[model samples]
Target: MNATDRTLAGLLSAALSDDPSRPLVTYYDDATGERVELSVTTFDNWVAKTANLLQDELSAEPGDRLALLLPAHWQTAVWVLACASVGVVTDLTGDPSAADLVVSGPDTLDAARSCPGERVALSLRPLGGRFPQPPEGFTDYAVEVPGQGDRFVPYAPVDPDAPALALPDGSELTGAQAVERARQDAAARGLEPGSRLLSALPYDGWEGLSAGLLAPLAAGGSVVLAPRLERLDAASLEQRVENERVTHTAA
Candidate 1:
């Protein structure tokens, strides 16, 4: 990461500049036998569209709390960066009633209805498919995001010192702090530029966020996320490691 990169957006910009075509997130769902890989450029485009959806459609602003109820998936990673870009503070495992907005996946729609603000649902399907039937009181993220502009411009600049993440333990981290911690974790894990880290961690806390997303972004490396990892047999896991050319492991 660059000395001046204090926010997730800055870190992503640096990565895009370094290599736009390199794979940044390689996601695998062993239970479904599904795999999806997103290059830096593609990932940025998804982030841009989602950011636009948050800023323009949802009218989400800086410091607004968004309850993010999703699993360790590629689209979840997109939402993380999208919230950062628009200065929306993401709450992982937060109560829906306390949030200004709520994003839930197929399994959490009922719980997410407590939020009075704009609600969005993700199908979490391959290629970002929409729900077969749109849930009541919630907009489909995959349906809404595609029509948004490819570029995103926040209404106000994000402050590096402003709180960006609200943890399950009720702790918060500013944008700068999160970036710094990601870099620190990357170094501690021996992650370097061009390294490939395979992760089988849930996205409910900092450990998973760092290993599955931020650490790779901080180190200019890539991540191979294996969600529902327990379902993968030992032989399948080994084959995945070999196929993805994984240099590091975080389980």
Candidate 2:
């Protein structure tokens, strides 16, 4: 990452510039036997679309708290970058009742209803499929995101010192701080450019965020996310590591 770029958005932009066609995130779901790989260009498109959805359609603004009630899935990673791009504060594993917007997975729909503002739901199906039947009071993310403009321009500039993430312990990390921490973690974990780090950590704390998403981005590497990794046998896990060309692991 460029030394002058102090935000996750900047890191993503740098990665896209460096190698747009390289794999950025590879997701595997052992339960469903599904694998999905997103190149830097494709992931950026998703982030741009989702950011536009938050800014134009949902009227989300800088510092607006968005409760992200999702797990360690590829879509969840997209939401994180989208929020960063829009300057919205992502509340990981947060309470829905206090948020201005809420994004939920299939298992968290009931909990997400407490939020009084906009609600979006992801089916967590392969290929970003929409829910078979739309959930009441929740916008289907798969339906809304596709039609959004491919390019995203924030209404205002994001402050590097402004809060970007709110952790479950009620702590906050500003954009610059998060980037710095990510870089530190990346170095500590021996991550290098083009390193393929496979992670099975849940997106609930700093460890997971650093290992699964931020560090890889900061280091200009790629991540292989294995959600529901416990379901995979030792042989299957080994095969996945070989197939993904994973150089490091954090489970």
Candidate 3:
């Protein structure tokens, strides 16, 4: 795809098309205390299936607010991409009541349910964890939504000028601006298309989404997400950068 046509979703689709078996994100889970590797093709499938569910089952519109309250991990990766694919506005902040739908962990699901302002809510069970009891009056996120296809029925292309995401403070950002920022950041770091990125941050914020993942994907590069590394100091960050040969490393 040309630079003009590149997007986070588009680049991921292209990468999987060329090398479905390529590794996307690899990390260890503290809950299971085990190492896990997620491939591009598998990750794409999760994104596709979840995107279809978001559009068909949840009836999410292109700009509808969707919140996530889980820990930063592969599931976060899937939901983030699903939101991008279907044009659902992802709200990463833990406040579930402020959203049309929410994906949250077992611990926070009860507190999330106490506020009844949400249109629909889904409790997100992290991988390797027991399906925790959903708070009263809440729904399990795993139930297949009716009419959700096995594959995604690509959502209509969103208006580039329309707001694609909402910040914790309720501020919004346009799709065009998000794309432009990703491109610009990659260019500034001399990490254009084909560069590789290794990020030690969570996708729960703009820095992780734009600079760490989307920017690299938009530029025909790849990102390896290492969530807990955020607690690392500057020395650790530099060590990772050198070992990974990461062209662009951001906090």
lDDT rank, highest first?
2, 1, 3
CA RMSD of each candidate after superposition: 1.4, 1.3, 4.1
Spell out the clash pairs found in candidate 2.
none
TM-score of each model, paired residue for residue: 0.98, 0.98, 0.76
C-alpha local distance difference test of each model: 0.93, 0.94, 0.65
Clash totals in order = 0, 0, 0
Q: For residues 33-52, write the lDDT of model 1, one tens digit per residue.
A: 88999999999999999999
lDDT top scorer: 2
Query: Across residues 43-108, which tens digit of lDDT does each residue of candidate 3 receive?
Result: 787788778877876677787777777655666777777887877777777466667777666656
Model 1 lDDT on a 0 to 1 scale:
0.93
Task: Kindly report which residue stretches of model 1 are placed more than 4 angstroms away from their true locations once superposed.
Answer: 1-4
By summed lDDT, which 10 consecutive residues of candidate 1 come out lowest? 1-10
> How high is the lDDT of residue 31 in model 2?
82
